[model samples]
Target: MSTSRHPLRGDVLGEQPEAMAAFWRLYGLLWSHGTVDQSIKEIARLRNARTTDCAYCRNVRFAGARDDGLTEDRVALIEDGYETSTLTEREKAVIRYVDTFLHDPAGLTDTQRAELLEHFTPGQLVELTAGVALFLGFSKIAVALGPPPGMPTLVVPTPDWAPGEAQP
Candidate 1:
């Protein structure tokens, strides 16, 4: 289903009306906290989209990442694992946290917390957690609504697959 053809009538704001307004107000405050760089924020979002396999987010964030000077190669790397790449230490830390939080919310160890503490201040940690959690929810909604036509698919190819088997 195309995102433009989503059953919802308006933006998240228009769709949920009062609830989204409250969310936007809260998000505005969180955005002001500046816990993570905007680039990191987008990267975290892309991570969430990838984790959720949300086509809408993958396409939107891919374009946004490129516009922000993230090369296609780097964005592609984010899918397999951002921490394994040449991103800065801090960027890798954030990606690690995002991965852990998404895949193991119930199993976040004290060691992981310490890793986060090493890279982020208390306020920044709060903001990072909030941002990651927010994107988790957003990606769910985007996938449920289905991405717009032409949005890229997040599926990776299996070794046995041939060309054209994986959707773009």
Candidate 2:
């Protein structure tokens, strides 16, 4: 892992601090009151990372997904659809919605909205949407910074192997 933080700290802090702070404040609100499932939150983050192609977020969320009890096969299935697998129907619905939200949020249909409503309260939906948007912003920041000079880029595991293990 690299010790270097964001390369464009000045821009991120000076030009974007207020916006970022708003996101953090929203996060605090969600944490304080939201009833969103932790697993659903992790799945949303993982999908967001995959959509953004952000290595940092992907790596971080891969570990988090595992910690949340998503098996290797289940995590792999998320890239496609995990509904046919062992995930609960609610979990499947959340992952499906996250995929659609990240890929085509502007095109979200009534059906998608209904699916979310079925599984989450209005406050939880707001919190989930806010979280997805926040991660999207963070991923852009990470990619723009371009890792660090001379640091080896870390690769996120692709779910066939245990995280942190060398594939044989």
What is the RMSD of candidate 1?
11.3
lDDT of 2: 0.65
**Model 1 local distance difference test score:** 0.67
- Position 148, candidate 2: lDDT: 38
- Per-residue C-alpha lDDT of model 2 across residues 1-168, encoded as one tens digit per residue: 567754455345446665655555565445334577556776777777788887766665434345557655665666764667777777777777777777776887888779778888988888888778777787888777664344333433322322343322
Task: Write the residue-wise lDDT of candidate 1 on 20-115 in tens digits.
Answer: 556655654554436455567767877888889887777664333345566656667676755567887777777878888988878877887887
Error of 2 at 21 (Å): 6.5
TM-score of 1: 0.72
TM-score, candidate 2, is 0.65
Choose the strongest candidate by TM-score: 1
Q: Which residue ranges in model 1 land beyond 4 Å of their true spot?
A: 1-13, 62-73, 152-168
